[model samples]
Target: MKYLGIILSAIGLMIIINSCSKSWTDYSALQVQNLNQDSNTALNNKTYQTYLANLRSYKSSKHSIVMGWIEWGDKTSTANSTLNDLPDSLDFISILNPSNTLSDEKKQDLSSVQKNKGTKVLYNLNLQNWDDSLYSTFNKIGYLLNVDSAFQSQLDSVILAINSLGYDGVDVNVEGMNCSSCGSFFYTYQTGYYNRILDTLGKLYGPHSNTEKFLLVEGATTASLLSGTESYFNYYIANTNDYSWYYQVDNAYATIAQIPGFTNDKLIITTDFNDKSVSADISDKLWQYGGIPFYTNGSGTPIPSSTALLNWNPTSGLKGGMGIFYINYDYFNNDFTITKNIIKTLNPSGE
Candidate 1:
């Protein structure tokens, strides 16, 4: 358990940071601002009428975004399936685990994958599992990523190459593996990396800073169930407490409602619904909680695009959550194009 010390110290540092910074957040103020801005922007869009036309077709007030995941190692011919097939007006496209398990060469090939798409990219960098070798490697990676100056110089070279090529942002996807007592190390490592990235991005891009970057971890909730991991929450929670921390919950609608503020803005509720029908049902309940609902469609399949403008009048409100569906090359085609159009046909950028 040599790594245990690293984990314990990491968690302890996080606890101190959190306890001192808890009451400084003002989520209500931010929510009100975002709402006003969204509502106003929605009024000025040319697609407003189109959105309305589609709204008449459905009976829901829910607003959501449709997203597809593009894998990094996909063969070049089909690698751009999701991007190329995405509707011209679509909101965002997430580039998932671009190089999750790819060899160095394959990983390098993904340099400019999303350049022309003009969509927001959520680039994923998933760490296998947290075991000794993994932790050891990660510590090196941590240094390579957020610490060691010399090693980071090399890492930065590649990340910059990615930015020059086309990636919009980073999605640090560290999940699954076992990290022993180093659980705290994982948390500390994650937060530290986030801070480093934010700082570096700000310096590099200035006004175009990637600080607006999106970070996704598959199991943010499960970590707390660990023996000494709640402390991990204590540290990073302070920094992320105000921001939306997405919880990958499936069919947890009735279950999540009981969690209080969990349904509030601080959370993003993601579920795996195979299609539109189930996705709608889950979203119906999520709306009442005021939480954003993200639905995942399995690999290679795209959800119907018309989903964005569904007319939802839930006596309460339309589900006000974003959409997150799974995708791969197999699902690529004109069908998905229609789906993306459906999404854009409803929710345009101004809206």
Candidate 2:
């Protein structure tokens, strides 16, 4: 009877051990699987961090940069309408109507792109023919700068807004400066005020400044207007209306290069994407001038022009870069085909 009870107890113990062994094996396998998943996650995260660092380093390098002007809109409105949908390799972007009125979703999208991609976001301060609803603050600043003696306050406000809103830089577009009715005194004063504003901005955000921000200017091409203040601007986006021929672009390049403080690398030649009548060849020649070919109009020949601009590079060296005015319009068939091509052409290595 004692041997029988001992045998039964041993059998029970074996059964319990077998069940515990099976459970332990299962648990061990699960732990190994979880560990593998964790390791993969860490590897992926490290790879992405390396990628971002490489991107930022490239931007800081002497290579040319791709710039675009995008009209801000809600991300949910349509495909490719938001900042997040822009090409990841784009170097810089100017928001056409960036203001305090931006929606939370739009702000978040802007922040995400700047953080994930090394794209610099610039605030567009258009001084001529801008919609009041979109650029009321800038328009007011422009008006005050032209007429008000206390325009320094408005200028301060602009800087404050740029800092508080977390913009990478500012794009100042001043057009219609050739006022036929205004006297020489008015013109001189206005020019001085503009230079003052640019000088102030340059101290803080110019290319040579300690800040990483950029200061860009357009339509201030006169010798008097740009002479002393030229150094304050990172790039002088040349007026593209007269660039219908290679010589025209060359002439404009020569003229701007003559400026005391301006350099060939600081010039940007713009074409009109809306003007289809412009030849793509003109866009291609922009590379020869050591500046980026920019799209400005929309009459007809956008694709060919864009193709020529992106594919062509000067043998002398890499051109400054290229830009598109209405960049969002290039988002067709649910893809940023032209923009992507431009980025790839400028930087052959994929970002």
Q: Judging by lDDT against the true structure, name the best candidate.
A: 2
Per-model TM values vs. the true structure: 0.40, 0.68
Candidate 2 lDDT (Cα, whole model)?
0.57
Give the per-residue lDDT digits (tens) of candidate 1, residues 1-351.
111011111221222222222111111111211222254553343343343333322222233444444543433443334343333333345564454234544333332223222345555444342134434544534544443453255347537644654555554333344556556655555544444443454344323343544333333443422222221110111111111212222222333233323322222323222222324444432222212232333443333222322322123433333333444322333233334433443344312
After TM-score superposition, the amount by which residue 72's alpha carbon in candidate 1 deviates from its true location, in angstroms, is 4.0
lDDT of 2 by residue, 280-325 (tens): 5555332222233433343433334455444443334445677777
Residue 110 C-alpha lDDT in model 2 = 68
lDDT of 2 at 12: 17
Predicted candidate 2: what Cα RMSD to the true structure? 16.7
The TM-score between candidate 1 and the true structure equals: 0.40
Using TM-score, give the best candidate's number: 2
Count of steric clashes across candidates, in order: 14, 17
Instruction: Report lDDT (Cα) of residue 330, candidate 2.
Output: 60
lDDT of 1 at 95: 60
The deviation in Å at residue 339 for candidate 2 is 1.6
